[model samples]
Target: MTFSEKLRELMTARGLGLRELARLAPCDSGYLAHMREGRRIPSAKLAERLDQVLDAGGELAALVPARRARRKTPKGKAGASIARRDVLALAGAAGLPRGLSGPVAPELADYFRDQLAGHYTADRHLGPFRLIPTAAAQYDLLCDLANAARGTLRPRLWSLAAGYAAFLGWLYQDGGNIDRSVYWHDVMLERAHRSNDRQLVAFALHNKAMLHADLLDGQGVLELTRAALQEESALVPKVRVLALQQTAHGISLTEDGDARDECDCLLDQAAALVDQIDDAYPWGGACLTPHYIDIQRATCLVRLGKAADALTLWERIMPSLRAAGARRDAGVFLARQAQAYAVHHEPEHAVTVAGEVVELANATGSERMRRELSALRTRMRPWAKEPPGRQLQELLSSMGGHT
Candidate 1:
């Protein structure tokens, strides 16, 4: 049977309606409806909630998309079932790994080392954005290594786990199982404290600030970002600076002029230090290019209502953003572009860009992106019946959403 079929059967057997299922699962009813209709796939985090609510022996597979479902080969043989167990093993490994085999299998050590660096960098580029399950897999492997080798593991191992936990907290802002992300963050922070690694602490705080930003808790963002900046060392790694910058950007959203000014100063400091620091390379996932900076500046300009300036920056940065396979990032830039166009009273342009935003948001299953697009739709509402307003409304309605 298909995953959705299983879900339908389970719900019926349990005497639950769609709304009741959504209530028990703690997600939007529409989101649940979409899943039931096979129009949407539940996130790993969401599946876990459904598992508990349905009392399905923690079998999340019953709700996985049909495409992701395990295949049964022969009755006596196990294929995907074993694969699923391996997947679970890896997840459990996130709690703790056996240990870093020093004299380690060169390949194993290399994988852990590479994974650690990759996750840290990935955290930077995502900018507190929650990651999909595939992306989270990287951190889980590194976490396993850290957990398995308590005393024998290198200090960097602890840093890796803490950094990953911090990233997880940012990515799964609303839907994640708290036990792994937030709870893990607390553990990571405590570990960082024990290690007395201020850089790691700062990085973790920056991530926590992003989580607060996701919650629209601007005060929390400011408080945590400030703490992170305080702990950031002049000689900190470049990725660490990027982490701080993400928090600074979050602070900019608070409309605090003083915090904004301070953030600017810190940006300048980061830039100046960028040239002087040796080996202060971009973390693999967090590579900051001139274009990335321009995008960041443009975002700030938009929030500051410097629409013309933001437009100029967007025009210049669009080529590179599109070239980087940064579809999600591009989608965001387009959403902002739509907003800037609306602010400038260019409805036609706003309509064009908003279309791009909705398309990308839908493709990525990004509710956050959809929310931003929804806000743009609201701003465009007063001009109803116009091509722009009609375009926005049509897109929202198609998504089964409203402003």
Candidate 2:
């Protein structure tokens, strides 16, 4: 039977409606409907998810056609040579294998881990556009390697693939491609489960929560972070710390009367945990610092409409942020600081900070920064004719009329 027919039969047998299946699959109902009607083919990743959700085992996944191979490059030519070069340099080898038919090297996983670390550092300074192509190519390479790998190497490669997928999701989110971001995060969660790594699983869920937080979906963030924290006692200190701070940010966005107080309590918990963390795992350790917790607390304060309080935190953190060389992050923080200035009725200061944000947004191609500036522009509409407001308007207008 066709995949859709089989899907429909399975759903009927289980008394599952379209929306119910979508929820269980954790995807959009409309996308599920299209798949049910055979208007679209499920990607291998989605097919795997649907199979598990419907308890079809391998039967459903079997229907997904293999992805078409990319067009062949010229002989002795490598596409995305920079990433390949980096891999070779890090691996200290002449070249990686072109295909997975040969026995994969056990140390290849280590090479990928190192490569991802470099990518993380680059992403801080270079943003997504310059890095995504190479990153995506490397992720595809990891997936191919994992598929043909066996024994102990298989899970390691899968874990690395999950990490790359999560990084791609974050990059897409920063670049404002929400749909692609969510898709990659789902891919990350699936691979994380396959790796049988509980810490990775928790990290995947928490990372997805970060995406929701960016979208200002307070309840969505809360739900995902809570799920991440379900096994908090077993998680590493860093994971717990990250989840706590994210949970605090979510609470601040909520309508709860005690949101600010709850947020503060959560931040305190996270900060205390930060002291227990070591540098063994560098994946998120950089963000588990006390200063990072303070940044998150500042974000929560802004969400809670305590603009002046948020500005105070921003002032203390701004110098350290610049010193850290995280240009994209600094830009995002500056945008928030600008918003606080506007809310505090410091229009001139707001405009000045916003102008800096606009430059960073253009330089970094950061949609998140642009979105922040857009919101600031809306808030400053009352002062549109004023010199400071007019300057802000012109700045946004220069960004393709995003105002």
Candidate 3:
């Protein structure tokens, strides 16, 4: 049977309807319906998800066609010139060299690292939409440099490339481009393994967990974070702390009766690890801060339906967040606060907070904030006809509505 035929048979065998299968695959039901009608082909990632959801083993994934090949460059010198030109194009966008010649200098890797640091700072204020092009270019340039380097320099270049890849992954995720986010994250994991850097490996795993967290895939977050902590002794304090906090986030997303308590335990462990981080470990970004752990704790409290407790934590952290001038992060915190108000039966307060979120989301063009606003809009549906709920809905609609 063909792929659609096989899909239909599997669904029938399992007594799974379109919406139910879509929920299990965590995809759009309309997309599943299109696939069933043979009007659409699933991407490789979606195919894999479908296989896992339907317990079809690898059969569904195997049905996905191979990606089209790029056009071939001419052999010898011509091909080399073409490749060099492409790399130079990426370099130009990344604010690097205009042209390539011989071996990639070791100093270039250091330059990339410094540039990445600047990009991180820029991302906090500017958000992902404005930064994605530059970040993607930088990642591409690093990939070219890593491929050209040799000996000890090679591994260092690969490690740097992995860092850039991870940043690009985060950018795409924040921009709401899930497919590109997954692609860049997978690239990061590959480059991390290529560098043979255990710490980088753990960091990559942690990043993937963050991606899952964005999707609210609790099990996925828990699994990846657990994998990240398997060699906890080998991780830097910062990475370990990040993994711990992420694990707590995963617990909060689950339906366990003791999720709040479990999350607190994880956060407490993370809090202890935070004190051990005396140096600026490069990987965790703003998450390296002492307040970050508490932010995660508050986020978990919100997820666990302890809105009042979350509101208390938000009140404590909002001053520091404002002082830090992390515009994108501030928007996220505000959105969460809005969620807390909605959950606590304070619709007017939720609308007021959501209005602030709309401004920040516009300023930074942060899809992350939009996503939070979307969830808030959904939560406020019970009061939809009321003025506060209608105001919140209108604010969200102004920001492009629910995703």
Candidate 4:
């Protein structure tokens, strides 16, 4: 059922009215009513309050989709024929390079749309680096389109081009191509700057900083995060909260006394704004929770040599981590798990987890994960005399069964 329908059904079951629920929720009745009717989406804050009022389970009250009748598709042989033709047309025209006439040749635009759809479909078919050519072609097309546009079309084309660049950057990052990711990120940033779009610029800067954070660059992380937070007036409150989170991540890595203190204060402010903040979750991942904060806090504890405290926090958060689909991408998440385990002197568990990660990395042929696994093995090399460590080293060299 949709959130609205669920809300209505739950209220009726309890013999409660909208006004009563609103009073208990301590939010505006009109807003609650609108939410019930699907006229509006409740902010996280509002949803939390309503969930409390309803004595509901978790934050999933809004996750249910209202039931709707599925539309019937044509099912005759002729329908299949038409579908085949449409697919062929889409495939034939998608991803063509643009011409010099300024506007992306219509064929080129068609090509871009096709490539985007293809990129998402049957992802295993294409390798990560293939996106480089696809993205480069689209970028050229967008530039031509921008140059060709006059008056109204000009701004629209520019926006499309900028958005396309941002998408390319996202693809590169997800594909584990950091160098290419930054290149496109820079392109997107420049486009956003040229377009005078503060929000877009904020997005670009935040994403760029995120890439650096992923690489564990302390100074780079701090610098870019500061740049993100510096535009206080220009950023929405939610964006500001994210900048704070990024700053916190950087501080966790640095182990600086003053910076750690500042991050603690910043996190305190972030926690207060939690309910008030709009959606600023990165990558739509479940890590966008208080649990994620706890995980980072745990990491900080580990860096501070408070292994006992860190271990407690890790144990607490592991369930959430498991629930967050960490097992699905066993290559990376398992490696991270191994890292956590290794640092805590649980070499046996780390070795076991590393084995699983290496197997997945080999299966996926992900050099990125393989590299990470290698690094972890090197760290555990000191324990080479131990059977588990020795086994881990051998596992690292040839992740696949060939060795």
Q: Which candidate comes out best when scored by lDDT?
A: 2
TM-score ranking, best first: 2, 3, 1, 4
Q: What is the TM-score of each candidate against the true structure?
A: 0.69, 0.77, 0.75, 0.59
Off by over 4 Å in 3: 1-101, 278-281, 401-403
Compute the lDDT for candidate 1. Answer: 0.60
lDDT (Cα atoms) of all candidates against the true structure: 0.60, 0.80, 0.79, 0.60
Instruction: Assess candidate 1 and give its TM-score to the true structure.
Output: 0.69
The global Cα lDDT (0 to 1) of model 4 is 0.60
Model 3 reaches what TM-score against the true structure? 0.75
Compared with the true structure, what per-residue lDDT tens digits does model 2 show for residues 145-254?
78878898899889899999998898889887688799999999999999898888988999999999888899998999999999899998888988899999889878
Could you tell me the lDDT of residue 161 within candidate 2?
Answer: 93
Residue 66 lDDT, candidate 2, scale 0-100: 33
Alpha-carbon lDDT of model 3: 0.79
Clashes of 2: 0
- Residue-by-residue lDDT tens digits, candidate 4, 1-403: 5667667877887788876886676543545675688544554555666777776674335453222222233455222223333433443455323334433334434444455445433233333443444444455555655676555555545555665677667556655656657777898788877656565567667777767776877778888878877767777656666677777778877878676576677776655555665542222122345465666566555545555666677667666555654332435545655666777788898788787777656555554566557656755766889987888877877655322
Alpha carbon lDDT at 210, candidate 2: 92
